[model samples]
Target: MEYFTELFFSGLTRGSIYALIALGYTMVYGIIGLINFAHGEIYMIGAFTSFVVATVLSIYGFPLLSIVLLAGLAAAVWSASYGYTVEKIAYRPLRHAPRLSALISAIGMSIFLQNYVLLAQSSEFQPFPELIPDFDFMEPFAHVVGSSDLVILLTTALVMVGLTMLIKFSRIGKAMRATSQDRTMAMLVGIDVNKVISVTFIIGSALAAIGGMLIASHIGQINFFIGFIAGIKAFTAAVLGGIGSIPGAVLGGFVLGLTESFATGYVSSDYEDVFAFTLLVLILIFKPAGLLGREAAEKV
Candidate 1:
């Protein structure tokens, strides 16, 4: 039972990060029907943003809490700019063109950003400072969770609740839903689909920043290349939960995290990736619509 509790909490922490990243994937795909392959790069940019900001702030002797908040703010701002610019440069031009063109452009941008980061930062891993200081309050239940993991869970819960409220009650949320349902109709209704799409990118990028920073803090090390593998896994999570469904993305993230955790614990750590990929394949084959995804019917 103790071992199970350990793995469960660990999986939940990882899943929270994955879900945060996965939401960006689902939102972009839902609104634009384009997979922003460069999104992972945006996440990488966010981590770098946090690293630089936190390091600089540390030099001035700021408290850990202030440093973490300000660093997150800086990362959010930087990633927002990247998101807006990427949409304009890489995706906006190909909106009316073939999907393949947009996909290719996204891939090109991904590679470009990856190299750009490698050049700007180091090609090697960088240590992430302790953003969330350890606490002994959870010492009694160390096997189940710790203070850091609790913070992660609380942060994820708050973000999700806020997002749900924004999507369900806000006017922009209404426009977003309309645009995702039917762009032509949304534009006809004066929703400004393009603006909606841009906002989606901005919000998604900010969310990605949060995920990146959280994961960086959790792992204590980061590099330019972490985004590539993380992006691939998040993409799989999006697909597994149904690409266009926000709730589905979250569900998929938890599922993937739990799957990997159990695989590592019961099976072998070496086969963790194999188990995840195998599950993806099986889900694709058995239920292509995804667990929470609605089946689409197209007319010829």
Candidate 2:
């Protein structure tokens, strides 16, 4: 029972991280119908930003709480900037062009960012500082879950709730929904479609940044290539749930995380990726639209 509980919590923690990144993918796709493939690189940038900020702060004798907050803020700000720029430079131009063009651009951007980071920073993994402190209250459940895992789960839940409220009642949220439903009609109705898309990218990028920092802190190491694998998994999670559906992304993230966790615990860690991809393939085969995604008819 203890082992089972441990695996459950572990899976939940991993899922929370995946969901955070997956939200970025889903939001971008929902708003612009373009999969921002470079989003993973945005996440990697966030982690690097946080790492730099936190390390400098620590050296300067800053308090733990202050370092965490500042690092997260810096990560979000920088990541958001990169996301907005990517949209304008790589995606915006190809908006009206064939979807293939936009997709290729996205891929190129992803490759560019990855190589840029590799050249700027070492290709080797860097140790991430333990920004999250051990909580006294969590001592009792220490065997089943660590303080970082608890923090990740709680933080993810709060983020999800806040995002839900933003999308449901906020004015910008309404604009986003309008834009997603019909970009042409949204522009015709006086909505700034471009601004809405930019905002979506900003929000999604910020969320991914936060996720990157948290997971890096949890896992204790990071590298330029970390984003590639993490991004692929999160993208899989987004597709698994329903690419354009917010709730679906969250659901898919948790499901994928749990599957990986249980597979590692009972089966073999060597086949973790294999299981995740196999599950995605099976889901796609059975329900092409995804678990919560609805099929749409397009005019030819």
The best candidate in terms of lDDT: 2
- Clash pairs, candidate 1, are none
Write candidate 1's Cα lDDT for 1-300 as tens digits: 888888888888888888888889999999989999998989989989999999999999999999999999999889988999999999999999999999999999999999999998889899998797777887787667877788888888888888889999999999999999999999998898889999999999998898888888888989999889888888889999999999999999999999999889889999999999899889989999888988888858
Off by over 4 Å in 1: none
| Per-model C-alpha RMSD | 1.0, 1.0
Per-model CA lDDT versus the true structure: 0.90, 0.95
Candidate 2, residues 8-109: lDDT per residue as tens digits? 999999999999999999999998889889999999999999999999999999999999999999999999999999999999989999999999999999
Pairs with backbone N, CA or C atoms under 3 Å apart (clashes), candidate 2 = none
Candidate 2 worst ten-residue window by lDDT: 290-299
